[model samples]
Target: MGGPSREMTVMRIPLKKAKHHFGASLSRGTRPYNEDAYQAGTIDIPAFAKRRPISLTRNPKGEIKNEVTPAGSSSGDPQVFYFGVFDGHGGNECSGFLMEELHKYIEDAAKDFELESSLQIKGPVHRYIGWSGSAEVDEQMPASGSAPETTAEESLGAVKTYTPSGTESMKPPKPGSKHDGPTPGAKSRQSPLSSAPPVKQSMSVRKAEDLERELVMDWKELVGGYFRRFKPEWFSMSAGGRGHPAEQDVIAKRHYPNSAVPNEAVEGIGIETVLQYAFLRADYDFVSAQVGKRDEDPVLADRAINDDDILGHPSRGGKSIGGTKRFKGGSTCSMALVSTPTPTPFWHPAAPSTVVTAHVGDTRIILCKTATGLAVPLTSNHHPSLPEEATRLRRYAATFVTDSFGEERVSGLANTRAFGDMQSKRIGVSAEAEIRRIEVTSAEYSFMTLVSDGVSGHLSDQEIVDIIKEAQTPEQAARDVTSFATEVSADADNATTLVVRLGGWERRTEGGLGSLGTKELRDWRKAEAENPRGRM
Candidate 1:
C-alpha cells in the first residue's frame, strides 16, 4: 500500500453494494479486558408530571371518571428509539456509567428543542455527563476476566426519574450469549503500569490526584441532582438564539420513521446546540473533575465561557446516590438520537425519523443506504494520530510517548478523547464531541452500524458492508463481522457492534409486561464470550 501502484490498485477495487439486514451481534475480541458496551431501547418524552393510568376511587364520592378503565400505561409522548455503543478504554467505568444515563439525559435536553418549534416559550440549557470512576486514582482497577460486564441498570440501581414506571426491565446480555462480550480469547490486557511514570510519584501528580476526587464529586452531584427532579436552572440556557445552521433540507426529506406527524408539517428545531451542550458538558466535567484550581490548561478558558454556575449550587452530599464508585478509567462513545415531530406512535415505536448523530472518540456511527447500498459515514475518529486531533494534543502540552507496544499514547492512553479520563483531560485531552445533523429519509435509508474501534480499527467500512451483503440476516452479519475481526484484526481488542434498523421495533399487544419484542434473536458476542479456561 505504500507505492503509487499499490495505492492505485487499492482504490481500483469497486466498493461492495450495501445491503439491508435485520440481525444484531456483539463480539468481545482477543483482549483480556472487554471494555466495549452497548444499549438499544426506546426513549419517550418524559411527562412533566406523573399520573396513574387508572386510579381506584377513594371513597367513590369524587367519582370523576375514576372507575375501572383497565389500567394501561401510555406508550410515551413524542417517542424515539435510541441505539448506542460505548468503547471503554482505560477501563469500563465510564462506559458503564454512560450506558445508564446518556439517553435519559438527552431525553431531558430534548424538551428545549421541542419547545423551540413553537413560538411560545423560552428555556435554559441543561448539561451533564455520566462518567464512572474517580479521577484521583491514576491506576487502572483490577481486570474482571471471570466477571460479566455490569449493566448500567445494575450499576446505577433503579434510576426512577423519567424511565417508565411499569415498563419491563431490560436484561443484561446473558453469559454464553452470542452477542454478549469478547470472543472466547485469552488475550487479556497486561498491567497498564507497563508504561509506568516513575519510581516515585511526583508531588504534582499526588497533589492533582488528591484534589481531583473532590472536584469530580462536584460534577457527579450536579448530574445526579438533575436526575432527582427538575429545577429552573436546568433550563437556564433556553432563551433562544438561532442555533448553528442545520441542513435545511434534512427536515423536508425524513418521513416520520417513528413519529405520528408527516414530514411536510415538520419544523427543524435548534437541536444542534443541545448536542453541543451535551458534548461540552461531558468534556468540561472530565477536565474540571481532574485538575487543580491552578493548572494553566487552555480548556480552562472554554470553561469560563460554559460557566459552572449553570449547575446551580453544588449539593451537600458530595456523593452520587447511584453508588457508582469512582475508578480511573475512560471510554469512547457513539450515540444516535432520532428526533421527530411524532406525538408518539403506537404499533411502530422503533421507526427511523433520523435527526442527530452524536459521538466522541473513535466509536463510529455509519449510515448504510438500503436503496442504493451507499455507505455514508456520520462520524470522524478523534485519535492522537489524526492530524487535527494531534495538533490539539500538542497545543494542550500532552506528554506524548510511545508505549512498550510502540503505540503513541497521550500520557499512556491510546485514544485522544473520551468521557472519564481525568488524567488525560488534565493535559487537555478533551471529551468535547462532534455533533452532526443527519436527516433519515425512509426511501433511501437502511440499518446503521454503531461500533467501537476494535471493529473499525481493523476492518474497513466497505469490508463491513461486504459482510452485510453476504450474510443471510442482520444478526448473521454482526456475527460474521465480529468473528472475522477477532480472528483476523491486527489488534483484536474489544469489538462491540450494534446494527440499528429503522421501524424494527414491534411490541406484542398481548404480553403483560417486561416481555421482549417479536424478534427472538440470539446475541453472538458476549462479555464472557471468551473461551472457557481449564481447571488448575
Candidate 2:
C-alpha cells in the first residue's frame, strides 16, 4: 500500500521446471508509497462440455428430488487462471477492496448465469429466480435499471406467421395440366399469380436471441454482485453482512455458450461490462453508506484522531487520515479476467482461450508479442480527454474540466471511471466498463502486463516491452521495469507491475556491474553492446 513510508520488498519463487509452469511478481519499490496490487493465479470452474446432473438432492425415502439448481461448476480443469492489477488513489481502501474481492465477484457472476440457463426450462419471464432485494438493487439507484425480462413465447409472438396453405399463391394445378405439363413451345404461364409469403424468423433464431439477452443480464448481475455486497459493510462495519452470498457464480471465459451461438469466436465481448459493474456498484455502496455520517461526526472524529492510520497504511501512523477526507477516496481498476486454454467439452476445446478486460482509470494491461518482440496494448487509458471518451461523457451527462496539463477529468478525476469516489460518481464519471476481448494465440503472445498509472505514466509500453524482452527472468523483468521507472521515468507516486509470460522464461547469470549504480556512460554502452539480447 502506498502512503507515507517509502519502503518496499522483493522475492522470487522457483517452480519445478519439468512439470509446473513458472509464475512470479515483484512489488519491491516505493511509488508515493505504492497503493497498487497484482494477482496471478489459477482457479477451478465446472466443465460445460456435457450436461451436468441437475437433480442433486435426495428425498426422505432415498429417492431423487426434482431439483432446479443451475448447471455450471466443473470439478476438474487443466485449470482457470486470473490476473489483475488495482491502482488506488484518494487512498488504498478501494484498491484493497478490489485486491480482496474482484475475483469472487466474477466467479459469483458465473453461477448466476448457470442458474439462468437452468431456469429457461421453466417459464421464462414469469418467475425471477434467486434473491430479490431493496428496490435499490432492482432499480440500481443512481445507476441504470435492468432491461425488462421476456420469455421466448412472449417475444416471438409478434413475428409474422403463415398457414401451410401458402396464402392464395399455392393453388395445385391439375395433374399433367398447364401448370405441371411443359408444352414444348408454350410460353411459361400464370407464374405471376404465384408469390411466396413474407419471410419470418425461425423459432431457432428467436430462441437464440432470447437466450442472448438473458445471458447478458445474468452477466450484469454476477459481475458486479460481490462489489455491491462487500464495499459498504467493510467501510461502515454496521453494513458488515447484507447481501445473501452463500452460493458463488462460476464465470466461463470463452467456451460454454450452451445453446447460444454455435460457431462463436474464441474471445468473448471486448472492453466493457462487469469490470464497470464492479466500480459502479462500489460507488453506490460507498455513496449509500455516507448517509447519517454528518450526524455521527463525533464518533468518526474520535476514531480518526485516535487511529491516524485509518484510511491508509496498516503499519504507519498518519492515524488522522479520512476523518478530514470523510473516506471520499477511490481506486482505479485495470484487470484482465483471463480464461486460459484448458481441456473442455465445449466446442473448439482445442482452440485458444480469450481475455476479457475492463478498467476505470489509467492502469493498463499490454500484451507483448513474443515473435516480433512488440507491445500490443490490451486497453487504452480511460480518461475524459480521449476523443470518443470526451464525447461519451457529454452524452452520459458528465461534466469535464481541463486540468493543469489540459487533460480532461470527470469532476477532476484523472480517469473517466473508478470505484468509490462518491464525488466523481455523481457526475458523468461512470463505473461503466469499456469492455474488450482478445484471443490468446500460441507463440504470438509474449506477456500480458498490468501496471498502475504511476508506472505507466512514466514508462511507455514499447519501453516496458523492450525491458521485458531483455530481462533474464520474470522477477528480474519487473525489478528492471520499476527501478528504471523510478530512477529515470520521473514520476513521483506509487509504482508496481505484474507480468504474465505466455511462454517459458529463463534467468540470466553473467558478470557486469553488480548493480545499476552510476557508471561511465561510454563504458556502460560498450558493455551493453558486448552482451547477448537475453543478457543484461
Candidate 3:
C-alpha cells in the first residue's frame, strides 16, 4: 500500500539466489503527498490431484441417488504472479482501491476461467456482480421491460447482420498475404490502400464483437455494483448493493466496435482478457462511485475538485491528505500478469513463462534484455497526442488541446485513458485497456521494470533499465530507480518503481550501460585530474 507518507515504503520477498524475486519502492518525491501504489504477489491456483469415486445411495423414499465427490485440492505453490503500478492523479482512492481489491477481482476471474476450462462450466455473468453466485438473472433489465433468458446463440440472432462493401471480402486474408500497412506500434507510413473503402465486419466477427462488448459491460457493471454499496450513507445503504441504474445501458449504447473476442467462451478465456476485465472493472467502479448522489448536489455534479481541493476540504480534520476516501480523480494503470507453468518451477532457468500486460494512461512496463541490455517496452502509454487515440477521440466528438509545452490533453487531463474521471468518460475518455502478450525465456530476458510517469517523465527507458541493471538486488534496483529520478529532476512527480527479476537475473550484459557508463567514467577522470591526491 502507498499514500502520502514522507518515508518511502519498500517490500520484497527474497527467493533462493534472488531468482524470480520482486521488489517495489514508492516515494512521494517532491510532491506534498504520494498518490501512487504498487502490488506484487502470487495467486493460488487449485491443483486437483485426486478425486473420490461416485457412489449410488438409497434415499428416504427408496429411490437410488447418484452421488459425485469433489476433487481433492493439492497444496501446491501458487503459479500465477501479478505485478502492477498505479499512478493516481486526483487522489490515492482509486489507486488504493486497486491496491486493496483489484487483485481479488483478478483472482475471481482466474477462478472462473479455470472452472470454465476444466469443468466446461459457462457460469452466468451475474455471478461476478456483487459476488453473488445465486443471482443468475441479469438485474439490469432492458429499457422496454424484463426479457426472457436467451442463450448466446439467441443473442447473436438478435444482432443485425453486416455486409461487406467495395473490394472487402467476408473471408479473412489468405495465409501469407502481404499487408502493406505497418504493424501495430510500428512507425506510421503511407499505404497504397490507405484511401480504400473501409471493409465491413463479417457476421461471425460481429457476433464476437458483441460478445466482447457485453463481457466488458458486465464486468464494468459488476465493479459499479460494489462501488454503489461502498458508501455508508442511508440512501446507498438502502439500495441493498445494486449497480448503477440505466448507466449500464448508457455504456452499452456507446459505439466502440472492434473490441474483438473469440466466439469460444471456454477456450477464449486468456490472461489478457482477465487483465482487461480487472482494469475496466476498477475504472468503472471508481468513476461511477464518484457520480453517486451527484444529481442531488449541484456542486458535486457541476464542479469537480482537484486533488488539492479534495485534500483541503474544510470538513476534513487534521488527517493527512491522499487517504483512501476520495470523491473524484483518476489513475493510470500498468500491470503484468505472469502465468508460470503449473507444478513446474517458476523463474527457473529451465522454466518458460508468458507475460500478459494490461495498460491504460501513461504508466508503463518494460523488459530488460540480458544480451543487449536494452529496454523492451511491454506497454504503450495512452496519451491524447497519439494519432490513433486522437482519431478515436475525434470520432466521439471529443476535443483535446495542446498545451504551451506541446503536451496534448483531453479536457485538461493528460491521459486519454484512465480510471475514474467521470466527466471525461462522457467525452470518450475510455477505460478500455491496451493489452499485449509476450513469451519470456530465462536465457534472453533478465528482469522487468514497472514505473509511473514520475520516473518515466524524466528518465529514458534505457536509462531506467541501466539504473536497475547496475543494482545488486531487486530491492536496491527499485530504490535506486526512484531515487535517481528525483536526483535527475528535483520536481519529479511521485516516483515509484517495481522490479521483478526474471530467470536470467544477474546475467552479464554486453551493453553494460554503454554511453551512460562512459559518461560517468569520463566525469570521474576529469574530477581526479582537477584535484591532487590529498587536496581538499
Please name the candidate that would achieve the greatest lDDT relative to the true structure. 3
User: How many pairs of residues collide in each model?
Assistant: 34, 32, 0
**Global CA lDDT computed for model 3:** 0.53
lDDT of 2 at 386: 69
Residues 289-336, candidate 1, lDDT per residue (tens digit)? 444234344565454432434377654544331122344567888887
Candidate structures ordered by TM-score, highest first: 3, 2, 1
Please give, for residues 1-536, the per-residue lDDT of candidate 3 as tens digits: 43432123223343323433667788898789899998876655432111111123312211111211122223332245678898988778778777777788766644544422211122443222212222222332112332233232332233222222331211222336574211222121111111111111111222333434555455445444323223211011122211122223323433347522222211122344444555665666566556542334545434444433554564353232223244567778887776542222334443445676777888878886655555678766677767767876776677789899777788898888888776676666666776665755434577888999888876657667777777778888888888877665545689889988775564624433432532353233235335665134
Could you tell me every candidate's TM-score relative to the true structure? 0.50, 0.53, 0.59
For candidate 3, what is the TM-score? 0.59
Best by TM-score: 3
lDDT of each: 0.45, 0.43, 0.53
Clash pairs for candidate 3: none
- Report how far residue 106 has shifted in candidate 2, in Å: 1.2
Say what the RMSD of model 2 is: 23.6
